[model samples]
Target: MEHTGPDAHPWLVALEQSGLGVAMRQSLLLYPAVEILHIFGFVLLVGSIVGFDLRMLGLAARLPVAPFARHAVPLAMLGFCLAAPMGLLLFATEATSIAANTAFRFKLTCIAIGLLNAAAFHLGPWRSLLQRGEVTMAAKLGAVVSLLAWSGAIIGGRLIAYL
Candidate 1:
């Protein structure tokens, strides 16, 4: 697909021409290193989230939900910290093309849905359930949704290379 000219936003042009973007595209070692870091970050992020969701699904029923969240939430947030900037840098390296990619768009949509689902859980049933130390149908449903959304996001991200 055509990615440049008037179709490309000014910000995307600037990003493509920026020093970091140029370096990321041009430097063999840097690009691979960045990709590796991105992989690690997402691995941590998704792994932690899925693990936590499994816990909510009764994998470790003996463990208190609140305490599990205390550990899991921070780990997931740390993974986000690691992943998000690296992902942005990777995007900046090929902004226009990635922007036009169907898989990329789907991946972003899944991420948004996943985040919204998480927020709804925390804001709604999860808070009270955590306090009460009881799992509910709603909580389990949220866990299922979280697992599906994140898994879909990961799948979409992987498909970016082929699609």
Candidate 2:
């Protein structure tokens, strides 16, 4: 397969010339609706994970970590799934700049780490622990990792526009 240079991608040029991006380029409101959707999705994810993770870490709710995790997993998944498409939408509008940006690379790396963390949690011992309706050391560890990954993803994403 022939790889296209970043500058040569037709998609990138289209995005750069998109009326939406060009119109709001100067205002903080650029892609306001898209950004809003992204934020809303992230908040949902935070709400789901935070609540579940905290409960696993001995917070209120006293939910069996397994059950709590079960419910929270969907929300976390939803949040991430929604945010990803929205993020990609924004990136499409400026792929050339984003691809060369350090913050964007970092954001992508963090997301990769997050996905790996989730997969590891799913396939490792935490899976059985979660099945038992009690939090184990592994569960706590996973929760901490989840918190860090998601938090880092958020920070990296926010920094994208700034940096």
Kindly report which residue stretches of model 1 are placed more than 4 angstroms away from their true locations once superposed: none
Per-candidate clash tally: 0, 0
Query: Which run of 10 residues does model 1 get worst, by summed lDDT?
Result: 1-10
Residue 119 displacement (Å), model 1: 1.3
Give the Cα error of residue 10 in candidate 2, in Å.
Answer: 7.0
Question: What lDDT score belongs to each candidate, Candidate 1 first?
Answer: 0.87, 0.74
- How does candidate 2 fare on TM-score? 0.78
- Candidate 2 lDDT over 1-163, as tens digits, reads 1123655567766666677546545456657878888898889877897787677678874556666667888988999889888877677666667766778888788778778877887797466775675667776787788788778888888887788
| Strongest candidate by lDDT | 1
Best by TM-score: 1
lDDT of 1 at 76: 84
TM per candidate comes to 0.93, 0.78
lDDT of 1 by residue, 53-138 (tens): 99889998898788788888888888878888899998888787788889999999988988998899999778779678788888
In candidate 2, what residue range of length 10 has the lowest lDDT sum?
A: 1-10
